[model samples]
Target: MQTGENEQALRKIIDFTRLLSIAILIIHFYLRCYHTFYKLKLTHEVVDHILLPLSKTTAFNTMLFAKLSALLLLVVSLMGSKGKRDEKIRAKTIVTYCVTGLLIYFFSSYLISWPWLYMGATSFGYLLFMTGGGLLFRMLKLRLGGDIFNKENETFPQEERLLENEYSINLPAKYQLKGKERDSWINIINPFRGTLIGGSPGAGKSYFIIRHIITQHIRKGFAMLIYDFKYDDLSRIAYNALRQYGGRSFYVINFEKIMHRSNPLEPETMLDITDAMEAARTVMLGLNREWIKKQGDFFVESPINFVTALIWFLKKYKAGKYCTLPHVIELSLVDYKELFAVLSSEPEIEVLINPFISAWRNEAYEQLEGQIASAKISLARLSSPQLYYVLSGNDFSLDINNPDEPKVVCLANNPQKSQVYGAVLSLYVNRINKLVNRKNQQKCSLIFDEFPTIYFNGIDNLIATARSNKVAVTLAVQDYSQLKKDYGREQAEVIMNIVGNIVCGQVTGDTAKQLSERFGKINQQKESVSINSSDTSVSRSTQLDYAIPGSKIAALSSGEFVGMVADDPGNKISLKTFHCEIQNDHDAIQQETAGYSEIPFPSAVTSSQVILNYQRIKEDVKILVDDIVDSL
Candidate 1:
């Protein structure tokens, strides 16, 4: 008797636990429905009245009605319970009850009396009921329908894991870059991918790049390398600001200074292969000192370093042995020690080393010589306070190691000089690449502004492979035409493809067509008309034909852009433009230019003025035509 009583007590406890679980699930379902309804504004009477009420019920009545129906289903389902067979029946019955309740509620709301309460509840309540029913049905289907839901499940495995470490970093919204969508400045994924800013010469491409550096990258403590080949007044201003931001340790290279170097062998004209080789050599040597110390005796230079391994290969080439950088790079991995020994033995290697050393030594001496020469020639000139103020007005000193404050390094000099803008860019990229590759740092962003002018040979390779090393590069270019003009069509395409993100601003003509094709197809329509008539008695018939054909490419506005992300290459996201506050660099330049005297000459008139003059001439032609017409 005692055993029987204990068994009965355990059975009651199990039954109560099951009842509590079911109650919790039901409550959760109702709360989800309520939340969804609130979000969609479906609980409001105003919307229901505007669309015409579907029923005479209140939102509370509709909710109560659903609950009562569900309770009835539960009671009826439990009353029929027998065993395991009854459990399956009960699950199916509950799903059916929920689904029927939703259908009945929607039909009465939309097709029947159109009450304000029913209309409001219909929007979100119907959605909730359907979702809950679907989930329950799926669970039942997985158990009883031979795992049909399991077979059809398409959820990604990785998505099930929590994203605890994926914190988002916010960017300031009021950047004044020009565009709507206040939320547009939020965390951007893969910003280093190529972004194209298109407009005419005065369309503010340089301005945007400078702002990005100062406000976004530098201000955030991330380093940036800019190559401004146009040598615009804006570049000079940016450089000055960078100098102030990053004290004396800040490295600023001017291409004009390289030309002024005492080395007679260094080419004074356009940058050729030799100049690139030299620049690469200098950077490699600088990097090698640290690499060697880190590796100690085990240090074997890879051909990618451009110093130890590449020098060895270049030496062989001088002695009638043919080789390329790629070949040396390939062999460097296989026989690093042998290559390092060969590199150390090369006599011709000294030719490259000597020039770099001489240039480095002469830099300070040249600065001293200029000071001495200026002092001797200008006792009176130096005494003039105004002259001193004008000549020595800007300070260019920066300390790079200050962690508390952000450092800004701006190349606001002539970019055309291969050594200054071009060399600095190359060195900066190489530095970051080495740091990431050797040390394995997971976060670093490199921004290359005005990219075309600083064309380096291996930039494409870097873009393609740098992601693996955690080095991200953002290349900002004016247009596709500019890229093609700078790097040729094939190379340009290769470089563009390597980048995973493409953001474009206003573009037209060939570029527009190209971008449109890349983003996806645009929908077009045409209209046609036909008419026919027949008479039984007179056998009269009539026919008519009309046709219209129209087609238009996708038109993107100034701040509007078509964003294509590589992760979802097929998806074309339309992003609102970034609004950036306009800086007064242009205004300052205008003021400075105004101070200079202008001379008038026949040849000095601009093309725009010449077009105006031609228009004036055309006015005479128009007068002649008017006289001829009058005479006729």
Candidate 2:
């Protein structure tokens, strides 16, 4: 009871001291004002005795009473402030206030001569000092909660970045950058440079990032080719977006259901033997990804050259009248002598088959069979009626970027049959790449989901050169190791380096480390404290550190993405990199998708028609073989 009473008495005295300091300042101001207005001395003995003793510390300048009152106010305020909720103020804050207050009290006394001017100046200086000291206290007292290692983590400015051009696609985003919550954008200012999206499964690669790219590109009227590896997942989005936006053209290539029938080897699409070679190489590598590492091996080159010769022969014979993947596959299964003899007649194709022909005539049957069997067996897998019917007809051309008729083509593959379909789909992708890369075409986007499932031959060349053609390529893979395994290390590295934009979520191991390194480093403040029985000390230092550490990337939650985007010269982005959660309207998307209409089949096919189509292709191949033998 006695202690409580003493504490109450002390609080009263502190309050009294504060009031007395304020009263002194008010009295000084009133006297100064009167002297300035009336031009008479208002001095008194009581004022001189009270303020002169305080002024002696600073040579008794004209700012005498104002300086004394400021000092008194500061002292009383500090004494009275136990801080709200009884929280103790930091020692550094208290010391800063003390030093700053004392400096203002003594320094203001020497600066002003007139009583009125000195009084106003000293009072203004004290107000400025208190505000500055409060700001410093807040800064010093900032607390680091949650992860300590994330303290001072670097974050670029999150401003609404956009090119606002017809060719660009911009996405809205939100983030906390430098302690301020900001709403911003992930602007693909020059999307033609290519984009690579990577993450583990369920990391929102399709949900947060790719979906936006699809919808935005469609909105901008880009003729697009989407490789939907999970069949209808992305296909549904493309179909619905097309309907919503009223796209000029829409088509789907699927083996199971009603699909658009188009010849991947349409004569105009494969302009020369080189186009055929590219097609053959893409197909073979897509089928046997292991062979990508052994590209120059005898067996690998032999099969590729053999397939190339067959495609060219079809392209030249009857002016590419019978040129289709089914025709090439059928020709591959014919007797080697008939096949080689027919191929040797064309001088352009003879050179490609000389090695095989030499092996055949020398009675090196084992080598000939080995050379031709690789392509024959692989092509044989794609010989079913469904693929034959699909690849043989020319329902539409691969020129998706045609100005007169821009098209949105979605080529979907079943994960269960990815190995078989990857080769055929790769052929389609390669052909479309050739078609879209011509100058003066409409702007286009080629989005490949599960990109590593198909081997995109000359992908490096495409990424390096296609920007001028306004072709935007987006490749999404689960991991870099998948690219290395499927596309070979050298080419995989080329693809990774050639891309201008990269977005990632929840990737681990070397992928996270590589991305972390790519994000680079920043100067960060690090604090360490040492304590002993005698003393406690804190040391602060700064060093370069990863902007977004690998561990943080590996631990990212769903919808969180870290990436850097390419910018255009006309509209530059000062902060191209980002660590953010791409804001999406979940309810809105759900509502939109909920009303989606299924992609209709082009025409219904019964079991009998499927069988009839299968037999007709076989009969055509046999008749062609017989005609060749009869002509010979």
Candidate 3:
């Protein structure tokens, strides 16, 4: 792993050769200058014949050129060999070599006759080519992606090996190099698998994500779905900037003022009666959280079906009026005498009605009543005052995928009042997954802070297909085991696998071990030696070791995150909060939020409106069922 000693050996050999070559050229010149007086014949025709390239006529020029070539070769070889780290190429090396070459060319020409030296330029050129060509060829090969296989400096084929040298991991290291170029912005490509941000509390994870990552993406015109679970910090931080700097619309589904409304079954989401029925089933299943272990019993499924059928009947007959969550609770409150009479002709809802009717007719209706009670209790939370307020009215809706005009939709769920807001948060996550489709391919980001708190059933499939839709997802959590606990082992693994870009901050326990293994192992050369009174032995061997251990991950400081960006697979990036002044102008931010200030709080719906909605649905269902029965 260490290279100082080996590089020193190579440097010594090259230095010795350079000095000897220069001495030979210098001593030959000294003898030639004194040969006139001493009448020396040390450089006779026989000696020139032995030295093939040292022709008698252009002797000084050829020798000087050879000496200069030795120095240039040394410069190139010492540029960045394994050991001598300090020998890396620098501005000084090129400057020194250029000046030395020019001086040698002139002095050699003066020593040999100028006319003859000019003739020996051919020999000088050959020497230069022979010395520098291999080095130049090597450099060209490295710059051109190396040889066909690139064995000399092999870059591992993606995930099989940890490419620690890649910019994704060794990032900012590349940026800090002596001379590097950059464009206006750093473009990261193909980063759609979503980023998983995990860090300890007070680790500055939120600040980095919002200030550095989220602000950058929004400025680049990416539509965002920011789920501010901690507070409205993300919403408050991004609201004005989104509209002013990003040139986009801003929508907030705020729970504090009931500032926004969302109908999950809204036609735009494409969740028809059957879809809502399935959603109801999923919700009831999640209430027990039994499905996280194994499939639910008949008792749980029976209640889910009964609720689904009622929701189905309401949504089927009432297009807009009675299909809201409030209506579902209102209809459930009606007496069985009136409810059965109203749904008498419908066969789909008959499944629940006949069972209740038969149990009553037989005077053994305890089981049927208990099922209704279970279903009602689970669905009751959906009709809570705050949830109904936020989910019922259609004062506004989030149009996230609009490509011509980008948008940022912030769903504010204050963690302090999580019990009141958790249901609505889960609803929004589910609804957005239903809304995203392949129709629009604009760049979008779904940022979920405190991700484990909200469980959306379609998240696995959503991440799988987001790349084609050009959507990115960022889920922030405190730990990895939390996901496995929320979603069972099999399902949790699926979710983690789909999110290829993992941005892990200081984490402990299983999360750290998992990431440490993911970084993979590297091949390193190690040396061992043994000495005794009788003999001595030395040997070098290769060993495999973890590139980055779990302890290192656990020791990461605040503002530092080890991430594997999707754009750069097989490599992990360790990023720190650089001193970057993002232009999150508060004035622009206020201007953006002001655009929606005129929207009033959702007005209370009167009893008359509720009755009218129910009457209209009953009338429509009656006519449709009559026609169906007539056809049958």
Candidate 4:
């Protein structure tokens, strides 16, 4: 932002500096002529009487050198103060200023020598002056129209200032830049902005995410946490990329088969009670949003509070391995007398335990039991054996606190395990989001594929605030209906409103209409036909219509996407719609897919990943050994 301000200041200074420079030249010319005429030492009579302002033609140009030198220093100092990438912009400004000065100087000098050529110089000067005037008028018009010329609204040509494929620290490249003028380097789209991508199946949305947003950053070494939904294809590709890049580790949370365990209670949150409470709400809501919606907060708030208090206690006091959700389920079903006894000795937990103990003793104890039962039923899967094994250990963790090394995590959507682990996924997202915002020492990118498949409410708020904390969220979804269904209509709207970059592929129904509305309106040429039926002639008139119909957006081809990305600082085209093409990489994809099917386990854990407990593995082996002995 300081860089942009400096550039604007330098530009204005150059404008006034040129006027001063011209004034200096005129003054110096007069001074030299007056000195020579006063000295009266010219050799030729023709030189003495040359034109109207005949005077000394001094070979020594000391005054001109001094004035021009001082002017150059001031302009150079201004250019030197701007930020790094502004070097190119500053160079261009300097070159243009020098060229304009040279043009005026040469034309004026020649016009004095051959006065007839004054006509041509006058014509060129008039043209240049008029062009500058028109530009000034446009700037004035824009200002009066309420577009404040600040860091956000400053205009720059984006087409010429391309940042290339190697640069990646934040979410810098959302769309290709259009810019205000030719020869102006292409500027990056919003670097610190969040994006939401929408596309139906096989519309090439995933391909777009890979090529445009993640791939470069992955290669450039920005830490990332990706939720690869379909088959862990994205995760596998990123794993290979991280390996090739070297020095960075890859982690996986495979739900289909336990490749590795990341204790679900890992660092519950550093913040006091609020963070833990929000996580509890997320889990309960994620499990049964419709139920909670129907019952309202009054019915659900107490259960959430109960869970929240437990979460806070566990996270604050216990190790991550022992702080699993199963502990909560076990405590919930235990006798109230036992629970009271357990809380009796712990002074810190008495405040938390008092409310639940009193609730159970109420005259409406059965009603309270029903509410507690409802929350427990929704969370009953947490007590299952397979999931318990997966949530118990600390084998792999995906942390994006460090940007020098990138990280990626994949959560499998196993049907058998979905009910058990769905809430865990929500918890991880909520926790990771907290980590990203809290441990904001380095920038991180989190990509959630088919994001609506694992909906959360705070996603909109995350998108809005993540930029400040240097975290980027990349969400991909099929359609608006899915969002509305999973997150409700109001939250879906909030998500749409907060996301800075909206990328849409071929979509139909409400999603198409939403994208069309978001891509906004455009002025398009049209034709109108008129007829005069006086038995003589017919007149036809053509005109332009100011609109882009929604049908046009819906008809976009596969691999083609329409987007409205936030503008870069100093970018001229503010919130303009752009079309991007992301062609499928068939061979590369085939390699990634083939590798996944061949792996004995999804990750590097072991061959028998389907089985969970180590004791179960031994039990099965012992049973087989006994059968073999009996056969012998």
Candidate 5:
């Protein structure tokens, strides 16, 4: 009995609230109408001598009545006293009607005689009031209707919302335009999961990448690991100089220097490799537990772990003391058969360890030997023991160790050696992922300037999985055909599926087609016809047509391209061309080239030597031009 009484009381309260709201609305309507029409004497004046001298006054009256009827209908519709609140409030329709009424009222006033021009003036005033009132009411209804009714409400699914947020990093406003302000600029969205930026010899791909590194990455304090394959590329040296002279804090790992070190592969010397191995171990352990649960108790422990333990066991056995944490895991030919047998028994485990095992068996341990030896020599070579005191006294940290501080590391490498580039990129990405995952940070951006050339295995997995881990990767590539050529059909398809955002510039060929299909949906049209014969026979025909699937990549001007986010469906990718002005630094170029020398001859050489020879020519040209001016 108490519950029923409470329910009744609640119902009564709801009823009273609704009644009060309706009463307030009615009072407002009455006050607005009375103030606009009655007190103003608008209706009386309109019916009196408004259209007096015209023989078509009746027709004019009918038109005025019709327009006023529309205005009233719009007001009543907004009141929502009618049932079925799910109906959409047609604000556009209401505005159209109000505008039409205003037009009619103005034209009708022209029919009034000069003596009653006051009526015309009154009519004009009422027209303005009605039109303004209709527009204000319509706008309010449109804004508030969604809140009042469930039918009008809309929201994105949680996963899609998260994807949009994650993919928002590639959004042009975030990283594209920074430091240098411009009236206009071109933004190319790397649609490929990994993009490769390549062009004519002097197309400025590397220059663009370097500019981004210096301006965006370095300035912002994000860590970058550059593999300087090109011996001539000055980004690495420039970064070092910037740190020394400009007080820019950055970590530069000159892989060339590391490669040249006596024992560059040592765990202590190769910070990148050390971090990668540790990450590999963590991934292996996770996979091991998952495999154990899925395959049941019969599943054997991961052989990688067993091999690791066996290495420790062997180290302990040889050292004449218990194995410690520093005992490194190294495999040899003797363990090959056992490794293969274990891998065969557990194929899933093989997926995690195969690459590491391959690296170990092939070059990792030998590389470690070189690295370890090099560290000792480097320590020995330090002129000041105090500098060594800072280095040798503490454990070396990862390239991105200082999370609180921003550090930019440049991997300045040549693009000619595709495999080497791939290896370097894979190593850097693996290292960054480890650092980010370990720290469990809120956000980090991985910008790969030219992505596709460096084809790292499992990059697709990284794209799909990294978002949840707060790592956003942006890949800038030239075109789709380049990706298809390097990664082949299957891997490229896998890559495309993983990335949520796609920004494309002017493209041609298969890439353009693929992008068009992916970003632009198919539009279909249908036509139908029916005929009845004299003999009472009926016939019908129907036809359907479809626009060919293609990329929205039309031939754009130099800097134009289409861009799209995940949620937007139609015509969202449309964007004007962005023109980035290339800034000249003559003084810096001169200073950098001061000590640089040119090769004596480049008459006969391989394609790989072109970039090097080109640099030499540039230096020689500068010298020759200076000499000519001096002679003059």
Candidate 6:
């Protein structure tokens, strides 16, 4: 009862003070206006009684105190009587408003002589402080609470600014920020540093990312070598892009059709017998991927050395006229004695084959056969008529980036025959990497789709070193597990880490988790709400979390991609990471594709002619063996 009585007394006092301040303001305004405009002069009695008692030192000062008292009374009334507590308002804010208002009102004393100027300035000051200060507090509250509904930290750095240049591939994209969609771009500022694209099938990796890379790089006149693992899908794109973009030379090495043939072991490009040893290493590892894990094993080294001796022998035989894969396969299948006899006759490789010779002389034929059998068996799988016709002829050189005659080359592999076609394709990839990764060559791009279908021995090294040589390599795979399964874990990790740009679509398991960790973390806000029968409470908090969660990566839509890119020193990109949907003009691409013509056959050669050519290569190998034996 006593507390209620005290509250009522305080309310009465506040109301009386408010009314008294209003009356004082009215009296001061009226007296100031009448004296300033009408030139009214007060008698001494009126000045002493009315002006000195009511107006104090100045009418403006009297009005300022009255208005300030009224504002303070309102604040006191609210603070003393409240139902729900306001989390926004604090004692500090109330004190700040009071001090700032007092300073501004006192500073307006100079305008007191001009009644109109004083009133206008006071009114402006009241509106500016009270109204604007209230709004600023409200903004502070909202910022502290954050956007709890959309929990993502959309405060990421995103810019609509795009950087384009002769060596760049700019992709149009869009991202979300605070529930608003904004335009963005994935700027491949320096593609020479290499790009790795990973996603599941139907993830739009090829449709959204790879196709753009192909068309744009081709448009820029880059001598390209594309590995179409699914055959004509990318091959057709390469062909049409070449025709539309005006390339100097175009070639496709496909075994299933009338395709151009290029020797992977071309003599002028192989450089030396060590190059042959490298080729042997690549082919042996490609054919026997399990051997990648067992690289230093004697059996593995034996086969690689045997194949090297054969390749170097052919490269030496008749000035390398027969230094082709078909010839190598034919010679590898020859009798062990004759093969060793013919290879050992070459003084350069005598020591290379001495182990086999010692085993043969000692009648340890089983041990000798064990070493040579793997090579013969692996090389035998590639001994197809179509494969021979494709790999034996020298329709063009492997140096596609020869600036004088820049070539746009696409080599295709059949999915049904990946094992057979993969070996030959790996050889091409190995050879082309060596040729294209040289100084002063035409700027080139090597795009490998379904990269795990074939093995690239030094793919990590190529990506690491190719940037300076102007060779852009783009590798696409279904998942990191596939890469680990095919390329071995150590090599797969090296390839994954070496690339400068990475774009990924829907993927799950370790791949998604790995990508999530690669994207790093950002500060994000989370809200929790609790309700009881009597009351409800809400709380907000912030913590460092994955910018793109692994679940988000696993749940990414078809056209959505999340990745980071490299930037050149001259063309720096501040926001290198992204989670965006590549905006492709489907209508334009479809219409353009509709106008594309079929790739023309370079010759009128028939399947029977291909068979005849295959037989002739075998006959050449047989006759060469005979001549070498006769000379010995």
Worst 10 residues of 4 by lDDT: 148-157
Which digits, one per residue and each the tens of the lDDT, describe model 6 over residues 18-55? 55545555556555565654455533565446754555
Give the per-residue lDDT of model 1 (tens digit) for 239-270: 44444454322333333321111111112211
For each candidate, the alpha-carbon lDDT, in order, equals: 0.39, 0.81, 0.58, 0.57, 0.39, 0.82
lDDT (Cα, tens digit) per residue for candidate 4, span 263-303: 65665443566776777887887787574344356568767
Per-residue lDDT of 275-345 in model 3, one digit per residue for the tens? 76556655665554555465466676677767676666666564544566565665665566555565554
Mark the regions of model 5 whose C-alpha exceeds 4 Å error after superposition.
1-210, 226-248, 255-396, 399-401, 404-406, 415-425, 438-443, 468-470, 485-488, 521-560, 565-632
Predicted model with the maximum lDDT:
6
Q: Is candidate 2 or candidate 4 better by TM-score?
A: 2
2 against 5, candidate with superior lDDT:
2
Question: Which segments of model 2 are wrong by more than 4 Å?
Answer: 1-147
Write down the TM-score for model 3.
0.60
Name the candidate, 4 or 5, with the larger TM-score value. Answer: 4
Model 5, 71-171: lDDT tens per residue? 45444543432222222346666566557656655465454343244345435544554555444443322233333321112110111111222123221
* Best of the two (1, 3) by lDDT: 3
Estimate candidate 5's alpha-carbon lDDT, on a 0 to 1 scale: 0.39
Q: Return the TM-score for each candidate structure.
A: 0.37, 0.78, 0.60, 0.63, 0.38, 0.78
Colliding pairs, model 6? none
How does residue 581 of candidate 3 score in lDDT? 15
In angstroms, the error of model 5 at 124 is 53
